[model samples]
Target chain A: MSDTSFDSQTREASFGDYFALLKPRVMSLVVFTALVGLLVAPGSVHPVEGFAAILFIALGGGASGALNMWWDADIDRIMKRTQSRPIPSGKVGAEEALALGLALSGISVIMLALASNIVAGALLAFTIFFYVVIYSMWLKRSTPQNIVIGGAAGAFPPMIGWAVATGGVSIESIMMFALVFFWTPPHFWALALFMKSDYSEAKVPMLTVTHGRKVTRQQIFGYTLLLAGLAIGTGFTSLGGPVYWAAAVVLNLLFIKGAWTILRRDEEVAEADNYAAEKSFFKLSLLYLFLHFGAILADAVLMRMGVTFGGLL
Target chain B: MTFRPDHELHKRRKGRNIGVGLVLVGFVALVFLLTVVKVERGGSLQGFDHTQRIDMVPQGSNK
Candidate 1:
């Protein structure tokens, strides 16, 4: 581990540095998916309770980010893409980041339990532990399948939200979890295809680094196929409707096509074009999750309206 | 103790720390208040109906 001590010459850390430690972009995705889960669950949550649930969920996600940054500071310093992160950049000390992460983890878990229920609180706590301890500390440098298994940590927020509303899990929450879980491999592999050197330099066992580009590309296509099935299958569930179904069909077709286009490209072709196809696929993956969750929320709202109006008719 | 020359920097850091501490305390108080409200209202804050029985009395107490 790198020295956790603070540098005396280091300037005072700004609020932005602390915020960067939380990884706001990832936190936004957590907030959005958790909101959709709460909205679509069978039971109703008061608006205030719902807000509190999402807030605590987002805090939990942020805590995980801080802890991940703290643990990964050494490798992060070596990677060009992550070299500017707060701890690596010397804007914040590693010890400070660890302290912030632990504090937020406690506060978020306890507040979530009070605001929602024990199940959601427990799930949030588990999610943090999994991401920080299992994924970041254990799997990240040890195995090529790190992202494949570690993806579960990212996939738990929506389920946590569902649990908050209903005090339990169900098919709807599981499908939501599965969607993110399966989408992670292809989504990350595409980026790995482009940023191969970063993983090699950091000695992280990403599939692209350990197994070669050909194997990684094939895996991306394979996972995308499974993701397509899960995405469409989710549309048939009680949580889905016509809007969600149509959205799922269109989005999955586009995603699969993107994966296929990536699979067809040789490394030479990818390098020549600066991994254009892979980059585009990576961009599409971001849209894929958001649209899927958005459709679920829309479907839930539509179904509620249908039941409310059907009573009058 | 080491001699410190940057007195202004030290003062600024102290001010910032105090500010952050106050904000944290305020946030904790807010969350506590919200939790209390939710529990007292029986898992909700809307539609106050306070006529529910507490069952605090004995079954046949004349005193």
Candidate 2:
């Protein structure tokens, strides 16, 4: 698609269209993980400071999303899943998206520095740069390992949140980062399996598109095993309690089983069922992160209430 | 052709410009207020104390 395709519009853009440019779904995950990171850290933050920290972190995440949309407008136009996005749909121009993204990025980073500490603001700035420059601009088109490496950009939020509270990084924050980093591969590969044609059509080198279904399934299974180990191992850290351990065990079991199911299916059966297993795994992956983070938040609250547990064996 | 001041598209664009300006102004004001609150609460804006230090001497001693 040509850039001119987005130049013609029959109506004015609505507020919702501008909001969509921020990729609210991704921003929500960033906010939740960052909140968990902040809440679970060792120190306490004042209520207003905590609120401001989260707000700035969210803005930073939204800024990255807008920048991603701006750069990926061409591939996004080709992909069925992203064709209705503001830039591609003639609701917002690419230059407008770029300006909004840059403006938000500057405001979010500077304000976060003022509201929290320099470490956190710097991390947020690096996260935005990593996502926009490294992942979106360079990696996504260049490599099938894009999501694997690109996952770090998304994984930084909780660490940023942890920094917001403690003004530094800790093992707990690193574990939180690792949790998301490991979870990202299997989570996105499942979506790739279901949307293989979209990636191929966009000429974006998703693992499924480049390596074929068998290799992709194997990779998913391999990453899931590693992710399961990390998820369960995280339960023994200071960040975890009985609640988190139990949630980890159950969620990992389900996630492993989902990966196993996908691995067992051949392309013929997968096609016949319209990739139901992959879709189901994708949905479960969403819940897997939410539940794990929820468990951590619960553990933090319990600890504050004087409830404690010995590390799970 | 005669000059026109109130074309619908022009009016809508003006409204949007004002709305965006107001939002930016509101954000600046909020940040200013937060900074004031932080200073009032004894939080250092520069991450360290900026007050001048003074030396003390014994009551009967002269330096």
Candidate 3:
């Protein structure tokens, strides 16, 4: 008697596949930025509560990712880049993704509220709703500026972290939010530049698909300029230090140079040389944001010690 | 007829069950730790005890 008999053998989904629905990579970014937000704030939280705060924030980010996947399952099926995702690959059902997302979203918000503060919890709820409903359901298909508008969802982590500590927003927290908000366009448009035909094939209205490579390149340069200005200017704020200021200077210079190189390239050159410049720029963009936030974190840590600017640690 | 313990479904289900069991255990531990931390910090000690503790004051409030 095979009591474990099931109707469909092809539906043998694994736990890892269910986990895949959460988008771990994106969750890492959320965790990192949220941590920077918390660590740099004016006050401090107990380490255990801080750890719990980060965990629940990450859970919230993952929940939104699951919701995004559920909403974008159709496009995910068509996109080569996302073809092997849990839903697209048939490892997890679309409805299961939705249910898990909803469950996790509720759990995360409540837990964060209990573990941290209501403000952080409310912000997490808004972030999930914004990403799933505003970004995924509406803006993604409706406009080329989806990344710009939707980028706000990704930028709220640090602010939420700050709220967790200070229990309110401040100018310093806004600066942190703006840093990621501006950085998102340049970083993602660079990907859209080299990732030719993926967005087009999937019918997603990325800047490159809606406008053209030339305009997308221009937009990339434009956003890089904005990002550079803000990144460097932030050094004067409470979130900055000698370390962050130095990092900002070097990173922005390199980023601007890379964007300029991309701006000067044409289809002939890009095609002939295999988009090497765009690819490198894409890679550099990852490092650029990482190091900027890393510097912020480093500065915060250094300041927590008796360290001083231009003086011995 | 006999149920095969070594069946493929059993193997997969074993892994799934273990994963789910670990998550539940972790959640319980998390709640326990949270309760401990909250009680230690006087964040959740507002009920049943009428003692006025200073740590119970909201961090943002001027008590």
Going through the candidates in order, the fraction of native interface contacts each one reproduces equals: 0.03, 0.00, 0.31
Best-fitting candidate, scored by DockQ: 3
**lDDT by residue (tens digit), candidate 1, A82-125:** 99999988889999999999999999999899888999999999
* Candidate 1: Cα lDDT at A192: 84
Show where candidate 2 strays beyond 4 Å: A1-12, A309-313, B1-22, B43-49, B52-63
Clashing residue pairs, backbone N/CA/C < 3 A, model 2: none
Compare candidates 2 and 3 on DockQ and give the better one.
3
Tens digit per residue, CA lDDT, model 3, A50-117 = 99899999999999999999999999999988999999998888999999999999999999999999
The per-model lDDT (C-alpha) reads: 0.88, 0.88, 0.90
Displacement of the residue A67 alpha carbon in candidate 2, Å: 1.4
- Residue by residue across B1-63, what tens digits does model 3's lDDT show? 996457665577778788889988988898899888877777535556846567756677765
Ranking by TM-score: 3, 2, 1
- In angstroms, the error of model 3 at B15 is 1.4
lDDT of 2 by residue, A40-146 (tens): 99888876778888988999999899999999999989988899999998888898899989999998999888888999999999999999999999999999999
Instruction: Please identify which of the two predictions, 2 or 3, would achieve the higher TM-score against the true structure.
Output: 3
Off by over 4 Å in 3: A1-7, B1-5, B43-63
Report per-candidate DockQ.
0.17, 0.17, 0.44
